[model samples]
Target chain A: MEKPVVDQAEALRKRAASRRRRRILLYVAAVLAAFYSFWPVMVMGLEGYNIDLGVIIAGEAFKTTTLYIGGLPVNVKAIIPTAYYYLQDLGLEAYPRLVANTLIVAGLSIGLSLAVGIPVAYVLARIEVRGRSLISYLLLALRTMSQFVVIVPLYIAYSRLGLYDTFTGIALAEQLIILAVVVWMLRGFFSDIPRDIYEAATVFGKNEWQVFRRVVFPMVIPGVVVTTMFALVLLWNEFLIADTLTGVATRTAMVGVWEGMSINQLSFNALAWDSLNAAGFLAYIPAIVVVLLIRRYLARGFSLGAAR
Target chain B: MGAETRQGRRARESRRWYLLFIPLFVVVGFVEIYPLIESLYISLTNLNGGASLSNYVTMVTTPTFWNALNISLLYSLSSTILAVLIGIGLTFILTQELKGKGIFEAIYILPLAAAPIVVGVLYSPSSVWDDIQQFFHFILHQPYFNELTPSFYFPVMFFSDAWEWSPLIMLVALSIVNSASKEVYEAAELHGASALQKFRMVTLPAVFRSPVMQFVVVLRFIDAMRAFEVPLAWTNWLGYTNTLGSPVDTISLYLYKLLYSSSLGFPLGVVSAVAVSLFVVTLVGALVLLRLMKAVGG
Candidate 1:
C-alpha cells in the first residue's frame, strides 16, 4: 500500500540529497553575507597600502616609476608595509593623542551614564515608581531625537561658558546619546530578575539599597559589563557631538580621521592615504575587538534587552 | 489601622527610590531637554533682535530644503526596507546547521562597529569606486563613470547603510529563531510541512510576532532619515559645485550646511527651524510606522 520498499528508499535518498544541497547553498550564502558585512572594513584596512605606496613612489627612490596598461595611465599601487611605516613616522604623530582623547571621553561618558543610569533602571524596574511609563517613553523619544536639535543650543552655551572644546564639555553633550541607551538596556537587564527574588530579599528585613546591593546588582553584573563595553563602542564611534564640541586638543580619533579625509580629498598635496586609512583602522580597533567579543550578547544589546 | 500605616510607609519608602533617577534626569535635562527648548525658542526668534516666523518662512520657501526632505524620505524608506529584507534572508541562512557558524557571525557583526563616517570614508568614490571603475575599465573595456552623480553616491550610501544596519535586524531575528522550541519545527515536519511552508508559517510568524522587529525597523528608518555622516563623507568636500549639499544631502546635512556654510553666515535661527521641522517629521514618521505595525500585527 505504501509502494515498493526499494522505491521508498530511493525517494528518501533523493530528499536527503536535496537537503544536503540546500545546506550547501545556505552555507555559501552565509559566507557571502559575512563578506558583504565587512567588505568596507576590509577595503578601508587595505586602502592605506595604496596611499603608502603612492608616497614611496612619489619619493626620490621611485621618481621614474610610471605604470601604463594598453597605453592608458593605470597606476596599480601595491601594498607596501615600509611605506606605511614611513607615513606613520611623518603623519601619524597625532594619532596616539587622538586615540587617547577618544578613550578618555568614551570612558568618562560610560562611567557617568552607568553610575547614573543603573540606579534609575533599578528604581524603574523594581520600585513602584510613579509615571514609569511616561519616563520610559521620554527616554525612547530622546533616543530618536536628532543630535542637531540639542547641539545648536549646546554649542552656544558651551562657547559662552568657556566649556567649548573641553573633554568634560564633549562628554556632557554625549550623555544625550549614551544615557538613553544605558537606561533602556539596563532597565531590560534589571527587569529580567524575578519578582520572587526581590520580594524574598525584602523579606529578610533588608532595606531597598541593601537588597539591591547584595542581590539584584550582583546578579546583573554580566549585563552591566556587557552594557559598559557596548556603550564604549557607541561613544567611541560617535561623530556629530564629538566633531561639533571638540577642538584641536580634544578631537577624538573619529573626528581626526574625518578631518584627514577632508584634507586629503580637498588639498592638492594630499596626506598619505595609507596613513589616514591606518588611522581610521586604528580608531576602530577597540570597537572591532569589543563587538566580536560580545557577539553572544549582541542580540540582547541590539534589542535593548527586548530579547532574552 | 496598622496595615494602613504600613502601606503608607512602604509607599513613601518606594518614593525615595525615585531620587535615584535625579542624576540621570538632571544630566539629560540640562544637556538634552534644555537645548531642545532653547532650539525651539531660537527658531521662533530672529538673529537681528526680533521674534518672527521668518525663519520658518525662509526654510519652507527654500528649494534645497524641499529637495532634502524628498531625499530623506526616499533614502529612509528604500534602504530600511532593503536592509530588513536582507536581514530576514540572513536569519534563514544563519539558522542552518553549518560549520563555522560562530566565525561567520563574528564577521557579520563587524560592520556594526564601524562608524557611519568610517563606512562613508571607506566607500567614497575616490577609493572603492575608483577600484570598481578600474576593474571594469581594464577587464570589460568600459568607460569610467567618474561624474559625481546621484546614480553613484546614493547607491553607495544605501549599500553602506545596509552593510552596517542589516546585522542589527539579523541579531534580533536570529535570537527569536534560536529561542523558538525545537518541538515546533519537529511538529511542523511531522505534519509534512515543506521547507517553504515551514519558513512561511513557522519562522516568519515567530520573528514578526515580536515587537522588537517593529522597533528595529523604526530605529533603522529614523536613523536613515537623519543620514548625515555617510553622505557628508562620501562627497569630495571642496569639489563639484558644493561643500555640503552635494551628490546627496539629507535634511541633517542641509542643517549642517545652514549652520556652518560661510555663505549662509551661520544662521542659527534658520538651522534651529530646520532641526525642529526635521524632529517633528521623524517623530510623526516613527509613530505612523509603529501604528502600521500594530495594525498589521493585530
Candidate 2:
C-alpha cells in the first residue's frame, strides 16, 4: 500500500507488441491458407503422371465408404458393389467420358455468360432509363442467394420445358445463376463511357446505333475482357447447381467430385483422404491458373458504380 | 430528303437495335425471374404433395429450423468478425508500401477460382490437413474439441474456410484504405501523432466503413448456408455439421428434396413456406446491409 506507480507507458508497449503479433499471424495465415486451399492441384498432377492411380484411388474410395453392421466390417468385394463394371473386371478403368461431359457444361456456361452479358451491360449502363436502380438491386440480391432456392421450381419448370438432364438445360441454368454478376460488372463499364464522345458521334449525323458502334463500344473493350475472364473463372467453380441439374453422361467436373464423395465413407485412412483429395485438385487446377493470369480485377480497389 | 423523315428513319433503326435485348431478357426471365417467382409462390403454400397448412406450421415450430438459423447466425457473425480482422490487419500492413504488394494480391485471389466443394475437402481435417496437424498433435493436444469427439476434425475446416476468404476480405479493405486522401495522413503525421493515434483518429474516422467493407466478404457465407455439395460430401449431412439443417433439409436443401421427391408425395406447401421465409429473411438482411453501407459510406 506504500507505493503507487502508474507506469502507463510500459503497459502501452506490451499492448502494441501483442497487436503486432496478431497481425503477423493473419499474414502468416493468409500465406498458409493459400497453400492449404490449393493443395488439391497436387492430385491433378498425380492423375497426369499415372493411369493406375484411378484403381488406387477407386480402391481407396471403397475403403473409406465401406460400413460395418453389428461390429462386423463390410467385405471389400461388396464394398465396390458393382462387379459388372467392365473396368473393375477387365480393367481399362478410368472413364474419359466423365471428364469430357463436364467440360461441355462448363464451356456452354462461359459462352452464354459472355454472349448475353456483353449486351445487357451496354443497355443498362448507357441507356440510363427507368427502373435502373431496381434492376441493379435485383442483380445484387440474386447473386446472394444459393441455388437451392431455385432447384425444385426450376426442375419442375425444366421438366415441363423438356430440359431435364440435357446439356442445354444445364447451360441455361448456369448462365441464369451468373447473369446478375455479369450485368452488374458490365454496367459499370457502360456507364464509364464519356457522354461527350457519344454526343460528338451523334453530331456527325450518326444515329444512336451508329454512335454505339462507333464511340461507346470501342471505349469499353478492357471492361469486356476483364468481365469475360472473371465470368469464366466464376462459372467454372459452380458446384451445387451442377450437382442437382445434370445426370449420368452429362455430369460436370464438380459433380464427379460430389459423386465420389457420396461413395466415400469418412472414417478411414490413406485411401479416403488421398483419392478424393486428388479428384478435387484435378477439378480446381485450370480454374486456379486462369484466374491468377488475370488477377488485376480480383485486386482492384472497391469501385463505386453509382449502381451497387 | 426531308429532315424530319430522316430523323424518323434513324429512330426506327434505333428501336430495332434495342429489340436485340429481347433474347437477353428471355434468358434472364426464363431462368432468373420466373423460377424466382415460382419459388416465392411455392414458399407461400404448404408443399407436401397433397397440400395443407400443416407442414408450414410444423416447420415454424421445428427445433431443426432454429438450429440452422443459429448456425447461420454464428457463421455469419464469427466469420464476419474474423474476416474483418484479417482484412483490416493485412491491409494495414499493405499500406506500408511494401514492394511485393502485387504478388501478395495475386496470392489472395487464387482461392476465388477454387470450388467451394474443393475448399470443403481441403478443409476436411481428416484427409487434407491431418498431415500438417500430425505435427501439432505433439505440442498441444486440442482437448477443447473433445466435447463433440467428431468435431475434433473441425479446427482444420474452420481454418480452411477462414483462409479461403481472408484474402477476399483483405482485397476489399485494401481498396478503401488505399483510396483515403494522403493530405489527411500528412497532417496527422506533422502533429506528432503516434502510429496508433494515426490509425484511430486519422485512419478509422476517415475511412470508418472498412469494417463494413470486410463484412461484404460474408456474402459467400450466406451463399454457403444453402450449398449442400461440400457439407453433404464431407459430413454426409451428419448430426453435427448440418444438424440444424441437414443436407436436403435446410430451406434450400428442403427445396431440392421437395422438387425431386414431389413424385414421392413431398409437401409443396411446406417447401413454399420455407422458401418464402428464406426469401424474406434475405431481403430484409440485404436491405439492412444496404442501409448500413450508405450510412457508413457517408
Candidate 3:
C-alpha cells in the first residue's frame, strides 16, 4: 500500500481558521441573543427615565446630557423617574387592592388545583386504567381551547349562578388553566419514579395508597413545589378570564394595568407609555422572582413537565 | 374457592383507585362541561328566539369571519414557526462552549416572566413601534410605517410573541441537546463527516426527533392560536376599533366583539356558534398534531 503524505501545517491553519470563524460567530450570536431577550425590558425601564428626544433636539436646559452622532441628537435624561409619578397618579388604594386580589385568587387556585389534581395525577401515573389516555387527551383538549370559548359561557354562567365578581369565582374560573397544568406536570413527575421502586414497595405488603404516601409522594415533593410556583405564575398573570370575571373588588393587578391604559387613553389622548410601562414592570415583579427561583426546574415546567 | 376470592379481592383493590379521579372529574364537569353544553344549546338557538342553525349560517356566510379566520391562521402559524426557529438558534448558541452562559440563559428566560398584557403594552404602536419608526427614519430615511397595515401589524405581533415564548422552547431544546452524548458527534467527525453532515446526522435528530421538543412545538402552536392579549391591549379591547373584524382582530378578538360589542345586540347565538366552531377546530388541530408528532418521533 502507498503511504499518503500529510500536510500538517496546512491542516493546522485550516483548523485555526475554522475555530476563528466559530469564535466570531459565537460572539455575534451572544450579543444578538442578549439584545433580543432584554430589549423590551430595557425599553420599558428606560422609558421610565422619561427620555425626550425633542428636548435634546431643541437643546433645552436642566440636567440633560446631549450626545451628537451623525448630526442626530441623543438626549440622556437625568433619571427623572416619571414612572414613580405615574404610579402615584394611579392612586395608592387601587394598587394594593389589585395585589391583594391577585394573591388571594392565586392562593385559592393553587390550593384547590393541588388538592384535586394530585390524586388524579397519581392514579393516572401508577394505575393502568382504561380511561387513562382519554382523560389525558381531554385535559390537553381543554388546555388548547381558546379562553374566549370557555370564558364566554362561564361569564354567563357565573353571572346567573351568583358566582360573578367574587374571589371564589375568579379562583374557580382559573382552575380551567391551573388544573390541567397541575395534573399534566404532576403526572409527568410521578411517572418519573421507576416502576421497580413502586413494585418493590407493593411487594412488601403495602397497599396502593400506602405506596403512594410513603414512596411516590415523598419522591415528588420537589415537583409539587415547582408545580405550585408555575400555577401561581399562571394565575397571577391571567388576564382574559380575570379581566372579564373580576369586578371592581376582585380586579387583579393585570386588569388594573389594563384599566390604567384605558384611563390614560381616555384622559391624556395618548397611550401612557411611561406609566403603563411602570405598572407592567411593577406587576411582573412577583412572577420574575418566582420564575428565577424555579429556574432549574423550568426545562421540565416549560415542556409542561413532559421533559426531564 | 380460596383462589377465586383472592382474585376478586385484587380486582376490588384495583377498582378503588378509580375513585381518586372523582374530584378532578367533578370540578371539570361543573366548570367546563356545563358551560360547553350551555354553549352548544345556545348555538343551536336562532335569532328570532327559536331553535335553528341561523348562527352557523352567519358564521359560514360572513366574509369578515373568513378574514378573521385567515388572520388567525397567519398570526398563529407565523408566530409558532418564528418561535421555533429563534428557539433553535438560541439553543445552538446556548449549548456551545461560551463565557457567561449562565447569565445569557437567565436573560433569555426573563421574557417568560412578562405577562401577556405587558408584552402587548410594550409592543403597542405608540411605544416600541414609534421607536422603530424613528430608527428607520433616521438610519434609512424611510417614512413611518403605518401600523394599520397588515404588513406591519403581523410582523410586530409575530416578533412580540416569539420574543415572549421562544425562551421556553429554547429551554426545552437546550435540555434535550444537553442530555445527548457528545461521543455521537465525535464519532461522526471520526467518520470524516463534514460539519453540515455532522449536524444533520447528529444535532438535528437529537433535538427534533425527541418527543419533548415535539410537544413543546405543538404546545406553542396551540397557544399561539389563542392570541388575545396583544390584539386586546393594542386596541384597548376594541376601545379604538370602530368595526368588527378590524385588521388586527384575531379570531378570539373577533369572537369577543361578537359576544360583547356587536352593534345589534349580544348576538349570543352567533357568538356561541363561533365558540363551538373554535372548540372543534382546536381539538382537531391538536389531534392531528399529536398524530403527526408520533409519526415523526418514531
Best by TM-score: 1
How well is each residue in B1-298 modelled by candidate 2, as lDDT tens digits? 6999998976776676567567777887877678778876665544344434665686678766665565555544555556556555655655653456677667656666777666665545444344334434433554222312335433433445565666666666555666778898899889987556777776665444453453364354565455544444345525433233452233444444445555535366566666667766676555544554344431
lDDT of 3: 0.78
Q: For all the predictions, what are the DockQ values?
A: 0.56, 0.30, 0.54
**Per-candidate interface C-alpha RMSD?**
3.9, 5.8, 3.0
Task: Spell out the clash pairs found in candidate 1.
Answer: A48-A274
lDDT by residue for model 2 (A1-308), tens: 42333456667788899878866765675566455434544433343232223344334433444434335575553234222222221232333455676667767876787687677677765554455456555655666655655766888887788888899899899875667766756766776678787778888999767877777878888877777666666666776677777777577766676566555644443443335545555566677787787665664312223212
Q: Please compute and give the TM-score of the first chain of candidate 1 against the native first chain.
A: 0.84
Residue runs of model 3 more than 4 Å from their true location after superposition: A1-14, A52-83, A86-91, A265-271, B139-143, B191-197, B235-242, B262-266, B289-298
Kindly report which residue stretches of model 1 are placed more than 4 angstroms away from their true locations once superposed: A1-13, A51-91, A268-271, B237-247, B285-298
Residues forming the 10-long window of minimal summed lDDT in candidate 2 chain A = A83-92
Please name the candidate that would achieve the greatest lDDT relative to the true structure.
Answer: 3
Ranked by DockQ, top first = 1, 3, 2
TM-score of chain B of each: 0.89, 0.72, 0.89
Q: Specify the poorest-scoring 10-residue window by lDDT in model 1 chain B.
A: B289-298
Q: What is the lDDT of residue B36 in candidate 1?
A: 86
Provide fnat values for all models in the order shown.
Answer: 0.70, 0.39, 0.59
Considering only chain B, report the TM-score of model 2.
Answer: 0.72
Clashing pairs in 3: none
**Deviation of model 3 at A305, angstroms:** 2.8
Candidate 3, residue B127: lDDT: 61
